[model samples]
Target: MDVRISVIIPIYNVERYIRECLQSVARQSFSAYEVLMVDDGSTDQSGRIAQEYADRYSRFRLIHKENGGLSSARNAGLEQAKGMYVCFVDADDYITEDYLCRLYEKAEETNADMVIADYREVEEQGNIIVKELGQPPRQGCMDRRQLLQALTSVGECHYATTVVVAWNKLIRREIMCRHFFPEGRLHEDEYVIMPLLLECGHVEWIEEVVYLYRQRQGSIMQSAETAMRHLEVLQTYQNRIALCRQLQEPELLQAFKRAYFWNIEIWYYLMRTRYGVESSRLYGVFSRRMWGALLRYHHVFGRRKTMEYVIFAISPEYYLNQYFK
Candidate 1:
């Protein structure tokens, strides 16, 4: 029988949450699916729990490997996936029973290469914080231009929408197979999401909340290492800027330049708060590059916004603490 969807879940030491996550997938309303449980050298009971599911469920297949990172585990899953569409789910996170049903129906309806759904971040105690969309305020089919606009949009629209995340979306296997996650790297999703979307001739968004993301203490985003690893975002955005420029896409180039500047501020704050680094030291390093960017992309910001950035460049600490406070 041909499987409609291949769910790729990278399992590590998520012993505390593995059963719940697997149970959610097992009970999914959509049955024409196979679950790929790629266990990345888990020392805890996570592997055992996953194996139990594999033994009991005909569609669940567990593959164990050495302790590669999340990206490596996901790549392993992709290698073995045989379904038309692929879905990524973190081992520590689960989904709604209708997650696959809704996403698959939308993909088939639109003939879309990719279909993204809404998700929510939940406390370990299961308290809901807020519901989020992969692409917000816009639904139905999306053009490439629209996708680029959303990708480079300001503030919460970037990561808060979870558009940069791989797990919240259902992607066609052929398109996904062409690209692999960057191994042993943070922000690996950021690197892959853009390329994946750009490759899709048809892309779509749905409003249903399908994935439940758990915010926990030891999670990658919550770790102190997140501060240092955030440096990786620079490479991702730089590559994006180059791609936009190479494509002669002036609008996307402008958007990426604007996003690049915004990212500097994000990095600065994280460095200060998470790493205990002083703002003064960071200011010296970032100000020079920011000035260069401001001059190079002066047309993008115009008079008022350029002046704001100039003032920010002059005294980022004061501007951030005073205005952002």
Candidate 2:
């Protein structure tokens, strides 16, 4: 029996959470799907648990390899996937039993290349907060251009980062195959998602909550060191800019700017925590470069609302406190 969807899970040291994650998939109402668990060299008992699940269920398959980071694990799963559609689920996260069924129904109805569903954020202590970033359109069909415009204009729809979690949506396998994620990057999703969205002609939005994203304290986004690694995030934005230019999609330019500004604020916060006032010196250099980019893409902002330009105009430290603190 051919599977309609391949659920790819990249497992690392998630022994504590792996059981719940796998069980959620196992109990899915959508039966015609295979769970592909790629163990990325876990030092914990996660691998053993994965193997146990694989042995119990024919649809579950396990692949063990040396840890090459998240991107490598996802790529390995992508290469081995055999389904019409593919959706990624982080090993530590769990989905509603009807997740695949709901996403698949939306995709089939709209004939959409992608279908995105809402998800809940679960804190370490098991507190759950449902996040609905924006209201979905009533009835059917979302125009790709209009969606992009709304997202960019409101600074909401920008892809990249975990905001566009690979797992919360179902994507056509063919489309995913056309664009492979860049490995060897700490923030691979930021580098990959925009291109995927650009290539997708139609996207379906569903209001139902399908996945639960666990927010652990020690996650990369929460760490001081990872937050200080702002250069990598900036590089992702640069790549997006180059790609947008090459494709001649000028409308996306504002989205890129919004993302860059957001990164600047985050970096400033990290610097404040790590180096205090001394951090301003390093930020001074970054501010100059950002100013240049803002000027080059002046059309993205108006004269009156160019607060970023004004703040960054003075000095990095000035903008740092103004935007971040």
Candidate 3:
């Protein structure tokens, strides 16, 4: 039987959550899908757990490789995908039982290369919150330009936001095969999403929550190291701007600038609050490069000129205290 979708899960040290994730996949109402669990050299029993699932289900397969981080694992899964559509699921997160069915239906109905769905953020401490639902104007025949405009205006419609999550969408396998995910990067989604959207041509937005993202205290996003990773994120966005400029996609370039500056503002706040004035090795380099990048992409600053001025004037500590508090 031909597979309709390939669900790729990159497993690391997620033993506690892997079972729930696999169980969710097993319960998926969409039967014409294969579950590929790529174990990225987990030191724990995560690999063993994945193997157990493979043994239990004929549709589940396990791929083991040396630890190469999240991007590498995803690329490995993409290389092995053999379905019309591909979807990513973090080992620690689970999806709705009808997730694949709904996303695939949307893709077929619209003849879209991708279908994105709304998702809820499961906070580590607080209650789960649903992000606002976006209703795409057209049910079918959504054009690339309209999709890009919708994504940029409403935020990254590719579901790259932690709030939106990459896992909540189903994309045509060819779209991913054509544009590989950049490996060895902390913010690979930031690097991959825009390019994929540009190449895919059309995307459908389904206003249903389909994935459950579990927020844990030990997750990288919540760790103290997140501040350090923010520096890498800034570099990724800078590269993204260069790529957009080379492609001569003016709208994408403007959108990248807006997202890039906002990220810088957040990073500066994080560094001040979490790392304080302690100068790390990358601190000086990051600060200088960030300012340079902002100036290079000066057009984006026109709308938020006051915000940029405030960012330049105040100490990071003050901004952190005022906003994050």
Candidate 4:
């Protein structure tokens, strides 16, 4: 193979972290891999920094384009990728030295369409370790249905974090290029991950922790609850539910509905309280939309879950002062 893997790193105002991120790619034990450092019109020195790496190393490829979001940058990288397998690394996050080597090895060994692994989350300051996330993809190759089950937490204990997230998986390039990232979307992964899983025949799981995800203070994940991004998440989950129906997986449908109920419950709680008060217009629209959705999908909840949602949805103030206090 000319290139076995193409590792994509989408850049945007990540000058602070881009060097570490690129250095990690450069240090990977895997030899037959290329790094597509797609700079999304970063005003900072990020593109220049990446350009320096591309200038120094043969494997590092710098792609500079106008200001588009992360998805657009990733899309550009994918379009120009010439590898059999593709994996994504966020501009702010980097991987372990043997990350690509191990993942690629598993893909070839198991003849898997996708290979999933574990990751670590560390706070930005002090390089202090916050915790390790060992969300299992289950050891061994999984069929489409099995992967779906693992992803949605249908019969499992909880949802696997690796399922919805774009990173932490080595996907076949053919399948990746077929499903382009949605341009200008907040939670871009939500639109693609499950569908890609459904298209795959086998997904290999391994215990090795290959990625180090940095937890920054002002990241979108942190502000999701308070900002309009909460709306994006709900929309994404609803899309998942619809995908389940399209697949005719009643089991998955029921499971996702249960998940959806809790998501709504939490969003409702947030909106009816302090965090949601910032944007009154958005809050009002979100409240009405969720209220309607709650009534429509009410049957998806069991008696207990319904009660749980109603308790918070009906009276967040009481719950906050009493139950939460």
* Best TM-score among the predictions, by candidate number: 1
The TM-scores of all predictions, comma-separated, are 0.89, 0.85, 0.81, 0.86
Q: Which ten residues in a row have the lowest lDDT in candidate 1?
A: 218-227
Full-model lDDT for every candidate: 0.83, 0.75, 0.73, 0.77
Model 1 stretches with alpha carbons more than 4 Å out: 131-135, 158-160, 218-226, 280-285, 303-319, 322-325
Q: Clashes in candidate 2: how many? A: 0
TM-score winner between 3 and 4, please give it. 4
lDDT of 2 by residue, 27-57 (tens): 9999899989999999999999999999999
By summed lDDT, the worst window of 10 consecutive residues in model 4 runs over 150-159
Q: Give the per-residue lDDT of model 3 (tens digit) for 1-325.
A: 5799999999999888899889999998889999999999999999999999999999999999999999889889999999999999999888889999998988888788888776676764435855554443534455655644443433333233522245777889988888677787676775676677777777777666677778787444444455466567666666666767776778777887776666666666656555553445445654565566555666666656745435543443444455532
lDDT of 4 by residue, 190-288 (tens): 788888887888888877667877888755434434465555767777778888889887877887877775565555455445344444344455445
**Ranking 1 against 3 by lDDT, winner:** 1
What candidate 3 gets wrong by more than 4 Å, as runs, is: 123-164, 220-226, 246-252, 274-283, 299-325
Give a tens-digit lDDT track for model 1, residues 75-159: 9999999999999999888999999999999999989999988788888866776644343546788788777767776555533
Using TM-score as the measure, name the better of candidate 2 and candidate 4.
Answer: 4
Error (Å) of candidate 3 at residue 135 is 9.4
Cα RMSD to the true fold for all candidates: 2.8, 3.4, 4.0, 3.4
Candidate 1: clashing pairs of residues: none
lDDT for 147 in candidate 3 is 48
